[model samples]
Target: MKRALLLLIFAMPASLSLAACAAAQQTQAPSLAKRPIEGRFDVAPPAIVIPPPGPLPSDLAGRLARWEADAASGQQAFAAERDATAALVAAAAGAPVASERWVVAQQAISRLTAARAPLSGALADIDRLYIERTVDEAVDGLPDIYALRDRIAEMESAQDAILQALSAALPGQ
Candidate 1:
């Protein structure tokens, strides 16, 4: 009797589920042919027209000038530091790791690394301006911005080469 009751309980749900599925299958979905048409699908979307960019603002132009000047100064300072660091590295090349000369050379290398900050900052600012103008669809100052960025990048690359040479010259590096 208990077995029959268990079978009945299980069969009841199974039967109900089967019946529900059958009923669902028997119900017909509304035909697409019978539905009313909406808007016309044949026409193409309108073209978007972007206006040409005008002249750069005076303040922005001044900022670019200042950045360029700062980059040039930084490059000069970097060149001086690189030369000094190279001399120190050469002097320390044969010195003991714990020697004062070696320590001073390491400090000079650190200073050389620090000198790159201005160039990097200028590059970052130029990149930000480029992105902002690009996003705003403004193309006026992009040429100048790009030229400055390239110049800064070249300066940075030259600085990096000097630093690498000096670092490689140092003992125990």
Candidate 2:
């Protein structure tokens, strides 16, 4: 037992030391592949710039009791719409969503397109200064909805191009 204990106690430290050295050497080696982007669920609350205390729309009064709450809800809704569109990009060749998801996304986009029409002036340093009512008003320059309209135009153009190419490839062409 004495001999065994002497070997075990002394040899154990040497064995452990070798294992530690091996681990350190392994860690020093360069990785063969790029690391993936980390999935972060830590969503920071969005900072909202609320429109001023203009005359509240009669219909909106009930939905927007407190200015902060109304702003938060609007922001949250917009965020959901934005994320859905991002997913639609990965949902295959077509829109990434389907059924109710597609419908809701389309509706949100439509509502957002309308919402931006009256945002004529360049964005103010502080969004709270704008009259919330005016956001729905039709301003100049393609009516503040150029972005959404442009997207539609691009989609139409792409479809037309595809059709044209197909026609050219046909046997009768």
Candidate 3:
């Protein structure tokens, strides 16, 4: 009888200790707002000073002019494709989107892909010129160059959405 009583006395405190530990864990976690932020939240964009246009070498001047022309044409084509896609969507508003809509979407994707090349080429030219020329010499048309790059990227995203629709509409070949 004494041995059993002794065993219960020792086991009771150990079980009570475990219960207290579990109760401590059941307390609410620390609030997230109390924690300090670890890293930066806001970063400012770099400044790009566009200087006055300097006299250009004949070859570079001619190349820039050609690039401008190509960019203009590509922009026009992209606009046209966008309009066509919008028209197709408007026309099919009531009906379930048909395979014909997928065809139109595929065509739009192809046109967007074709139109991107020239703008990409123009951006590459700007990058090359930036590297080759002095800062002042390179800054004259920087805004226009960046605008074309941004426009192309936006169009690429639009094309990607259309491509996704096409794949979903006509899965596998």
**Model number with the top TM-score:** 1
- Candidate 3 shows a clash count of 0
Each model's Cα RMSD = 5.8, 22.4, 13.2
lDDT of 2 by residue, 1-173 (tens): 99999999999999999999999987867777745554364578899986434443454444323433333344444444444443432332243345554555455445543333222111221132234434755233222224333443443344345334433332223
Q: Which stretches of candidate 3 lie over 4 Å from their true place?
A: 1-54, 90-98, 134-173
Better of 1 and 3 by lDDT: 1
Writing each residue's lDDT as its tens digit, candidate 3 over 19-80 gives 99999899997776734454355468889996566455566666767877776676667666
Looking at model 3, the pairs that clash are: none
User: What TM-scores do the predictions have?
Assistant: 0.65, 0.21, 0.42
What residue pairs clash in candidate 1, if any at all?
none
Model 2 CA deviation exceeding 4 Å by range: 1-65, 90-108, 111-173
Q: What is the lDDT of residue 150 in candidate 3?
A: 65
Error of 1 at 107 (Å): 0.4
Displacement of residue 131 (Cα, Å) in model 2 is 8.0
Candidate 1 vs. true structure, TM-score: 0.65
Q: What tens digits encode model 1's per-residue C-alpha lDDT throughout 133-160?
A: 8999778877778888899889888888
- Which window of ten consecutive residues has the lowest lDDT sum in model 2? 117-126
Clashing pairs in 2: 88-96, 91-96
Comparing 1 and 2 by TM-score, which wins? 1
